[model samples]
Target: MNKSAHWIIYVAMLLAVLTVTVIVSLSVGEISIPFKDIFDIMADKESMEYGILAYIRIPRTLLGFAIGGSLSLAGAILQGIYRNPLVEPYTLGISGGASLGVTFAIVTGLHLLNIMFLPLAGFVGSFTTIFLVYTLSLRKGVLSVNRMLLTGVMISFIASSMMMFLMSITAVENIHGIVFWTMGSLNESNTTMIVSMIAIALISLVISYLFATPLNALRLGENKARHLGINSNITIRILFIITSLLTGVCIAVAGIIGFVGLVIPHITRLWVGSDYRILLITSFLSGSVFLIFCDIVARTIISPNELPIGVITGLIGGIAFIILLSGSRKNSRII
Candidate 1:
């Protein structure tokens, strides 16, 4: 098939899979409703069982889809920016910082965080990490990937330590909520978080998509990219902004969900090659699929008890990442 035909088929298949998965996700829980009744409830034609479906299950399923897609796409962008196979949206300590911010909000009796303020704290935390990393990495107007990576690692350790301190000081009753945030749950789905996350994801995707040419130029090395009329400084700065926005927004909504960003792009690159155009788009879809599937397992594994979505993702992602690393190492040795 031509590339167009392939894209059409892929998109159609993804939509179908997502549709079925969403329905299945909605139908599951303490009460099992038949697929037909679930459809009817969605159609607004109504049955006595529609109440719980409408009020409860739908929001959760939708949030799963949104957060899954957003985090995956964010990971794809990070992979491109760092030119690293393992980097994810949270690789820059944005998520750790956001976690700290959320923990702060929770402990401070900030009612807004439980609702709207949590995302704001996440944004603050995310940008602060970005700012610190940039400040530390920029010396004599030069930015090095190694410097950025080291800074992020250091910041993550510090932020995580702060999170632990807050957890220790927190009251036993509220510790559960803060601890849950650290573990990463998609449980706090609401219309507000959904809207905010979607907006950030879409904006970041659009901006990053526009950077395909520049990113490709970047792959040619800093000096070579600059020779081609690509401003390395400008491109890196834009990339930093985009990554911060994506990581911040995701942490705001989902609270430090891991591995999807780190693993998704490397897998996508295996099929889509090095072209950012195809890489970013496919990464978004595949990342969404992978995350939603993981979420499904999280909700179903213990039935009547939801596992933290982050735990399941981390387990699977960690294994997959190891395999990829092994393969990449073999490839490097061959070259």
Candidate 2:
């Protein structure tokens, strides 16, 4: 088959998987609602099942899909920009910035005034970090990708250190809140926030396609890309901001869920090759599937008591990546 035909087939398969994931995410929870009953329950809003499905699972599912897709998309973009497989969204210090903000909010008890303060704090912190990293990386009217990566790492460490200092000074109860937020959860209920997250995720996906050719050009290295009439710096900068903002929204919306950004894109690349045109959408869809599945496992594994989503992603993503890498190495294939 032609490459385009194969790409379409792959996308169709991923879409089918995403559909299944959404249905399964909505169906699995404290009480199992059969697939057949979900639509009926949606229509019967007065039913208790309707309330559970509508209020709890629907928002959570949507957020999972958005955050998961966005993070993975961000990771893919970052990896392409840096020409590094290990570069994930958090490598840019976005997560650390968001975590620091959450820690601060918990420490100051501002989160108690309103839960919205938590996400607000996280977004502000990430944006501040983005600005700081970008400003520091600028030299003679250029955004240095290498400098930005190093600066981001340094800033991430500083943010973590500051967060630790705050934790050291805060109450034990506050510490628990900070710890839980860092571990991550999708327990948010604000419909507006969930809708916003979904919108941002989709919009970012659309925006990413505009950079697909540039990203593919970048795979040949910046000097070569520039030789081919592609403006490497502008593309990288634009993508960096988009991915950073998208990641910030994910972190702000749903605490620090790890591995979605790192593992999802890596795994998708292994299966689909490094073409950003295919990689972007596949990673987004697979990420949605992976996270939503992990979330389902998270809330149901212990039944009545839930494990944090981060824990599941960490355990699963880390092990899976390691195994895949090992097998690929043995086969003389590279990711």
Candidate 3:
């Protein structure tokens, strides 16, 4: 089949999957509301299941989808800009910075003032780390990918160390909260948080989509991109800001969920080819579906005792990444 026809069919399938997944997620929560009752409750707010449907399941599902899409798109952008398939928010230390922020909030007792404060702190930490990494990686007016990677790794290590120190000094009772935030969860979802995440995810995705041509040029190589009249340096800088915003918001809302950013982009690339315009949209949809499915497994695998969403994504994404790496190596040897 032609690529365009294949894309149309693929997108239709994804939409179907997304619909089913949303319905199933809403229906299979703690109370086990029937699918019919779920629709009924949505139609009539006075229904008994209204609170659960509106206040709990809907927000949680939406937040999960938004966070997943944002992370995946951000990862796609980073991979394109850096010309490295393995680069992602988590690997590049953005998640570590956000984790440190959450840990700091827990240690400082800022979480007591308001639930929103944690994400705020996370954003601050993430942006700070982005700036630091970018500044450190610049050399003679050029952003060195190798230097950026090394700096990110070093910063991640430092952030992890700081987090461990905070954990050790924090009260035993507070340690669980810190650990949970780092692990990631969506149980605390609310309307305000969901709205904020949706806004950020949509805005960032739109902005990133507008730069798809430049990103495609960038993938060809910096000099080639500049020859095409694209300012490689400026493009990279703008990409960094957009990715930082998306990563920061995702971490703030959902904690340091790993692997979605790393795994989803590669998977989407395999399905849709490397065109950023198509890749971005497919990645967002695939990512949303992937995370929602993982979340379903996470919550239902142990019944009433829910596992952290990050744990599920990490386990699955880690395994998938290893397999992809092995396959890539085999292909290289064959070539």
Candidate 4:
């Protein structure tokens, strides 16, 4: 199929999946609201059902969608910039670093500072990791992809050790909360969190989308992109800022939902090729759909007792990654 035709199919599939997932999520929550009730609530918007639907499910579900989509979009930018298939949200240790911030806040009883402190600390950690990786990878003023990957791995290991130290110092009673947060949860979706995440995500997505052409030029390597009138440094700077912001905000709100960022972009690339224009749009929509569905499964699989959303996402994402890799290898041999 032509690129346009393939893109149309992928988008249509995403929309269909999104619609089904949203309905299933609303209907299958702990309260057992019926499917018809969900539709009626949505349609009428003034009834009692509407109040329950709007008040409870809508905000949380929307937050899940936003969190998933934002992380995936950030992943696309990261992968594009580094030209690496294995890079992911955890590569920069952002989520682990964020978890450490939260742990420190809890251990020290810094609840007042909790509002923005955790996220700020998370950003500091991630930027530190990024800079260290960049510095380590630079040799004679050029960044080596292998060095960057190695640096990220080493930094994550170090950050994770710091996180363990924080956890060990905390009291036993507070351990559960810290552990739960690290495992990841979407239980804290509120009006404030939703609004903040939406604003940040929308702005980042717009900026990333607008820079799609330059990103495409970037894929051709620094010298080639420079020859084509693209300033590689400026592009890298912009992408780092935007992707870091997206990653920071997401880890701040959702704790540490892993693998969606890594998983969704690769899937989108497979179905839509390397064009960031279509890849970006499709990744956002499809990532949201995937997360909501995973959440619904998380709630229903044990009923009354809910599993962590991160657990479900990681499990599904790991399996999906293997499948995609196997198929990619097969395709490569065929070509």
Best by lDDT: 2
User: Which residue runs does candidate 2 get wrong by more than 4 Å?
Assistant: 330-335
Q: Relative to the true structure, how large is the alpha-carbon lDDT of every model?
A: 0.76, 0.90, 0.86, 0.77
**Runs in model 4 lying further than 4 Å from the true structure:** 39-52, 112-145, 331-335
lDDT tens digits, residues 31-112, model 4?
A: 7778866666688977866766787678768877888889889888888887776677677666656776777776776645
Name the TM-score of candidate 2.
0.96
Best by TM-score: 2
Of candidate 4, the 10-residue stretch with the lowest lDDT total is 326-335
For every model shown, the clashing-pair count is 2, 0, 0, 0
* Backbone clash tally (model 2): 0
TM-score-superior candidate, 3 or 4: 3
TM-scores, all candidates, are 0.90, 0.96, 0.95, 0.88
- Model 2 — which ten-residue stretch has the worst lDDT? 326-335
Error of 1 at 241 (Å): 0.7
Weakest ten-residue segment in model 3 by summed lDDT: 326-335
Q: Evaluate model 4: give its TM-score.
A: 0.88
Candidate 2 has which clashing residue pairs, if any?
A: none
Colliding pairs, model 1: 112-117, 113-118
lDDT of 3 at 33: 87
Tens-place lDDT per residue, model 2, 99-122, is 999899989989999989999999
Query: Deviation in angstroms for 88 in model 4?
Result: 1.5
What tens digits encode model 3's per-residue C-alpha lDDT throughout 205-268? Answer: 8998889999999878999999999999999988987898788888888888899988999888
RMSD each, Å: 2.6, 1.4, 2.0, 3.0
